[model samples]
Target chain A: MDASLLTIQPASPEPIYRQIVEQLRRLIAGGQLGAGDLLPSVRDVAAFHAINPMTVSRAYGMAESEGLLERLRGKGMAVAATVRPTQTQTQRLALLEPQLQALVRHARELELPADAVLRRLGRLLED
Target chain B: MNAMLKDAADRPGPPLAARDLGHGYEGATVLRGIDLDIAAGSVLGLIGRNGAGKSTLLRALLGLLEPTTGETRVFGKPALAMDDGIRQRIAYVPQQPEALAWLTVAQMFDYLGRFYPRWNHAFARDTLARWQLPANKLFGKLSPGERQRVELVRALASEPELLVLDEPAAALDPVARRELLREIALRACEAGITVVFSTHIVSDLERVASDIAFLHQGRLLLHCPVDDTKERYARLWLPARLGPHAPASTLGRRSHADGSVSVVIERDAHGRWPDEAAQPGVRLDVLGLEDLFVEIAE
Candidate 1:
């Protein structure tokens, strides 16, 4: 993956690591990345982003711990198998619904019709 | 050996792992056999006197310096082989903001924005405005504080997963320092970005760091959580008594028996002290990171 593909939002009260994790998770779920795909090494990520390897390492470690990715002994990290739909997933996805709904509500407030919204959503999904 | 390996295998892997990390100048060794692990999403403050290899360690971690001996991995990936895609997720701010001196503030942004596909233009603009950095001014023309702000903007703009800062606030004024620290703290708390910052100033570490790794003589003398250090260490004031013989159960060495003897205790939980001194004037004071640094350095 090119470093240019990653966007960072400093204003969002989110810590940099969580932002990276969330973005990677979204990318994986969206199929931009897949199982067996190798991620960048921590130092490379840090230098490219001009942050600390420790922070990137933390995010990777969290992802690994959560089973989002698997670590090979000498090979780099790879996306884990598709996440199972456990009770936790249902509850977590439920919690995220409100945020997604708010985004849709904002789109509606902007006077965007359902077709426009759907089109944009489809485009985002395609991306 | 197998049992020891099994025991080691049973433990969790380090948050940050470096293998046989070595660096040097000419023939002298600056860092050697350095192996370190910081827990996930925790703050680790690196401290050492001048020329004690703190900066070198940071550079090595960033792959800025080619190590002489071993390798480093963030999480578990080899740092040396980090791909550009992976690099997008990490952030590093050096101690000195000299890398982009030729570009104006605006140009610097424009240049860096090209590298990160996800660069947030609005956030960068807003931060520039907040810092009052003149977009037209060349980076070299900015004052130290202003330059530091530029570095801050660049680092934060990336929304990095890991933040490695080398004395990031060294040039900032007190208020700016506090503001930056608060901002960093907020990021760490909300986003879980792991932070490893190096500083000679103890107060800075005390204000934001949860864990500290003391580097003395190119070696890590102690690495522990901040709370552990505070709760376990105490300053002991012993009155000269007990027939001039000092108690042997102290963490620090006995002071010369002047009128009053003072020692630092590493493990003191109870509020009371044994009444064996001549004047019975024993008092305990909690030692902060600064005090701890002074004692350890001594």
Candidate 2:
């Protein structure tokens, strides 16, 4: 899996580590990541994100705890076989609802109608 | 989270742990009873005032300086006695970007690249091009910021698990600093490399750092998540007519109960203020990492 698939939101109250875990979880559940796919080494991820390795470790630890990944001895971490797709999707959507609501609210505040918003959304989906 | 903890629990030993670390030079104590732990693949930020002994602590960790007392361990091995194999997994970038004066950028990189087994040539070349750094420029002739970038490129190209950078952005201009940080961020994301860099620039730390450790008067003042610090720490601006008495619970640099004043405080999210404290003349503002540093260090 491409390590750049991870995204962090610093402005949100959620810590970067948690954000990393959540994003990875979403990708794994969405089939963007496959079981046994090797994740980037901790140093690479930390350096790429310009964050401390401890933060990445925490996120990785969280994912491992959730059975979404496994840290193989000598080898780096990989997606776990036991990840639950439906459960993860539900969790991700629940986590995303507030942000989606805020985006829709702001769109409405900007006087964008439902049809215009849906059209833009459709265009985005098509892309 | 459970699986991670289980894995961590099942692991036979600690990754990096320091205990009661103390250091001094010629009877002048620099750091005392310093204790820290860094799991593999985690980044840790070390922050402090000018004389707070941050460099000393780093040197102690690197075994460049002998700690007067206590123990330092990396991956459960004694830090001082680490073998070349262990050392190969770690990299250090000092505060001053130092290199052989006569070596050109490419020559310098070529020379250092020989020592590291995991040196990424393609990445180095890409970084050189992306940063617009001239490969032919003499090390000594380059500007301070350029020199710093060279040091960063050298460190990043090595692909070490633990990279310790000492104020890599100090000499960089605003744009260069941002670009350098962005590059570092990108690399970290790609490699899962652990990083610990020291910097006085709080906003830069805020931009990328996940964990922050504040050192003051030769000791660690606080170590916590950046967000937690921002949420719990605040600076309260109060008027002079409030009287000579300062708020008893707050940690502040200065207080003027008799005049307009600003007080820094660490309070719970739902904290309440005294009736007198809530007067019309008072204002409250959250303290950024810099403000918190000043308050704690002072």
> On residues B254-283, what C-alpha lDDT tens digit does candidate 2 reach at each position?
754455666666654466544434444455
lDDT of 1: 0.70
Interface C-alpha RMSD after superposing true interface residues, each candidate, one decimal = 18.6, 8.4
Distance from true position, residue B18, model 1, in Å?
A: 2.2
Model 1 / residue B26 / CA error / Å: 2.6
What stretches of model 2 exceed 4 Å from their correct place? A1-127, B1-16, B137-144, B236-253, B257-263, B267-284
Reference-based lDDT, each prediction: 0.70, 0.73
Question: Which candidate's DockQ is highest?
Answer: 2
For candidate 1, give the docking quality class from DockQ: incorrect
Tell me the DockQ of each model, to 2 decimals.
0.01, 0.12
